[model samples]
Target: MLNVLSILIGLLSLVIVIPAQIPFLGIANWIALPFIVVGLVIGQLSSSNGGRNLCLVIFAVAVVRLMLGGGVI
Candidate 1:
């Protein structure tokens, strides 16, 4: 459950960043990357699910989270 929560919270961070127009957000964006990556790694590296499916899902979710947080989503 925490994995999904982390994903959602990461996405929410992006959602909140949407209205702001600061330059530092690009840097702030880097911070979120590890969280997404960790979550992805956890979901993929630990799950019995094949690495390909897990890696893809993790990468996709993380990128989407980044985009939403970066105002691209």
Candidate 2:
């Protein structure tokens, strides 16, 4: 379910964050953002703290990317 997707997108985010400046791939993070948000919402719907925590970590990484001016530019 969403827990699995959250984990997958979370890992994907790590890779995307690094190569986000590669022109065509620069939109990768932006694309993943929706998936990440979906995962977060779905994770919250579940009762497991682990799922929510993983989503949060993904969110944190997204935030860090923004703070570092890593958004699509």
C-alpha lDDT (0 to 100) for residue 40 of candidate 1: 52
Clashing pairs in 2: none
Show model 2 residue runs off by greater than 4 Å: 1-18, 21-26
Candidate 2 lDDT score at position 64: 64
**Highest-lDDT candidate:** 2
After superposition of all CA atoms, the RMSD between model 1 and the true structure is: 6.9
Q: List lDDT for all candidates, in order.
A: 0.48, 0.64
For candidate 1, write residues 2-59 as lDDT tens digits: 4454455445444433433254444444555565555456545443434334444544
Q: Which candidate is the best by TM-score?
A: 2
The whole-model C-alpha lDDT of candidate 2 against the native structure comes to 0.64
Q: What is the lDDT of residue 29 in candidate 2?
A: 62
